[model samples]
Target: MSLPLISRAPGSGRRTRRLPLGALFASPYALFLLVVFAVPLGYTVWMSFHRFYFTAPGAEVDAPWVGLSNYRDVFTDPVVQRSFFNIAVFLVINVPLTVLLSLVLASALNSKLPLRSFFRAAYYLPYITASVALVAVWSYLFGTDGLVNHALGGLAPDPSWLVNSSLAMPVVAVFVTWKNLGFFVMLYLAALQSVPGELYESAAVDGAGRVRTFLTVTVPGVRPATTLVTVYAIITGSNLFSEPYLLTGGGGPDHASASPVLVLYQKGIEQAHPDFAAALGVVLVLFVVALSLVARRFTEKKEG
Candidate 1:
């Protein structure tokens, strides 16, 4: 009689494993990112170490490797230095303004207020509007003969909002804050909803006033959202390009309103210094990353 056939686990002897359905479904997005982001990022890093220049199709050019010379040049460049400073100022104003206003507006909207839906839509309208259109309206409003100047009359600065070197970046910062406020408000709104109603009841039970309750309950409750908003504001503020580009006319008035990205465009695309621009882009990325980390740390720090 033959020995009893031994039953084994399914696929126990197989040399290969079947791909997970989740991975299979994710492959398209993975491939897309590899092609679009990874490849280009790799090429940029490679170019940053060389003296790269554009050449016509089928043309060969000597791209000498320069190690960190590109980086050194980027640091020494005055335009880049000024751009960094400008971005710092922008962040200083934009980050706090955005966070505070968004949180306050969200709190008000979250309360029993009249026309709540209409106000939410009204606030969000600017965020969804085309930047080009917004810039045009802003230009008109802040121009030498614009409504803002018209309203200010004799109180307006001598050089107007967009032209003054000291005011240009600040104006850009404010404009960005106003434009993106609704999105951050939405984030806070979601965070606020997630907060336990019990906390509010307890706070009220303790005789906490509105402001006290908000500080004790609402603010701490949305810590995660605050961190998110802070980091996002920093990143977006650092990469500011279009607002300054269109609003300040390509970072005019001695490049006072210029951002690192705007400078990168000027160097990389406009000036045809792709290698140098690549280096600048790399540095900007590092800077933004550093700033984001610092912001996250500050926001997420435990109260001692």
Candidate 2:
């Protein structure tokens, strides 16, 4: 019976009988992307090209399409303009400083220091905790009559944090840096560990000091990683949302910290204008993409 079964030719379906479990698992995600991500993304672009403010609570804003009107209005809206400007300022201040700090910490951790793992873990704890919790802690520290002012004993805090417009954006940046610092540290640490020990040893033998070897050898070896981390920061930073949302209480202190995502949230939930909110989303996506591309080019030039 076995011989007879072996003599029979396998059918076309049976010829490839084993199922591709990987594809089966992956297809749902692929389909989910098309359905959830691609479809919504395309719809948002369509919505962004039109005027979509409230005509009434229930009535449509425009019966006819108004191409690029929403985008024009988005740029012109005082709040929207301020948000873009604020994010630009935040990125300018934080990105470079984050890179520099991460590198320095990574270099220090790479050395023959005592309690190396303990220090590394301590530095990385901020990254492990939820940002929402971190923002809450920061809130108390910056409160009008909170610990910071109390610690000053007699000197005034001048203007209250969490309420002062001038201090709002920078306070937001500090929270961002604290939460983000560990991620970049981990990135740089990984890159540092990958550098060939031989390279440093040889450089040292040739009279290169620690600082000199680091600048010429360690830094160069991790250039690609440095580029990747910077670009990642730019992308993530451009999408500033939860940090400002929690830290500034939805752009409190007269909306000084109202980031694009907060703006989008107001449009959708507060304003009940999904179409307009969708437009805000489209613009945010474009900004991140463009900024990432620019960063990539800059990183490439440095490598070249």
Candidate 3:
């Protein structure tokens, strides 16, 4: 019998095989990831465990070992606790409101109605507008004597929306929801479109009313989109920074609206405590990971 072509010599097989030529094509991107993402992440982790700071404005390297002291301080710090509380309140309020309103707006837009396209574009316009410009417009409307107060018609006093500690975080959450609503609406609209028209027709043939059809057909059909929207809303709501920062500077009249990112900014850039900021950033990443895991569990459960 002829020797089997599949057989390999033991020593010959031990020799390393060359990487595919496709890896040559991927080299640049791999290098970019290593340089841009991996290196910085590694450096941040290294810095997080040490007392690191620039000796001068241009200095790049000066860190003394501090072990887990920064992390310990991060957990014990009152400002950090306040920041977490602020993010918690924002997430609790913003996520549900955003998801619900977006679903409604998407369903409305998906319907055959007059001026639907115009309304879609109009709603999406806020999402495309510059953040600073949006903030300025919101600030104008929320001014003590401005349109919102004027619209109230003396039903209530014109409270300072951005200045009041209790109201500031809620206002920020609302602004975030409004700004991002259109994006989520677009997501749901796409999901709604993907739902088969046959399903709706069948529901109608079965004597199902609009509400019944919606709950049984429409909602379940878009479950994936709902999960995506919920997870996205959670991440964005938890990481809210710019709205609060621009609306009410320096943590909003008693650290009322301070997000973890704002705390990182204050510690790293403002106070020259990069090590502590790195630790805070790591903690925030862990928080996001844990929340995302819980969300994933719920999503998978619903799917099951």
57-148: candidate 3 lDDT, tens digit per residue: 77687588899999999999898899888877887777788768888889988878999889989889989998889988898787677688
**Candidate closest to the true structure, highest TM-score:** 1
lDDT tens digits by residue: candidate 1, 1-304: 0101222237654676576986889999999999998898888899999999988999999999999999999999999999878867887898789889999999888888879889999999999999899999999999999999889989989899999999999999999889989888887887788789999899889999999998989889887776666677667766888898999999978999988899999989999999999998887777777866665554444221
lDDT to native, each model: 0.84, 0.74, 0.80
Candidate scoring better on TM-score of 2 and 3 = 3
Model 1: ten consecutive residues of lowest lDDT: 1-10
Instruction: Give one digit per residue, the lDDT tens place, for model 2 in 114-194.
Output: 999898889989888987788888888878777887888677446776777877877787678778787778777877877
lDDT of 3: 0.80
Query: Which should have the higher lDDT, number 1 or number 3?
Result: 1
- Would you estimate the TM-scores of all the predictions? 0.85, 0.78, 0.82
Which residue pairs show backbone clashes in model 1? none
Displacement of the residue 118 alpha carbon in candidate 3, Å: 2.0
Clashing pairs in 3: none
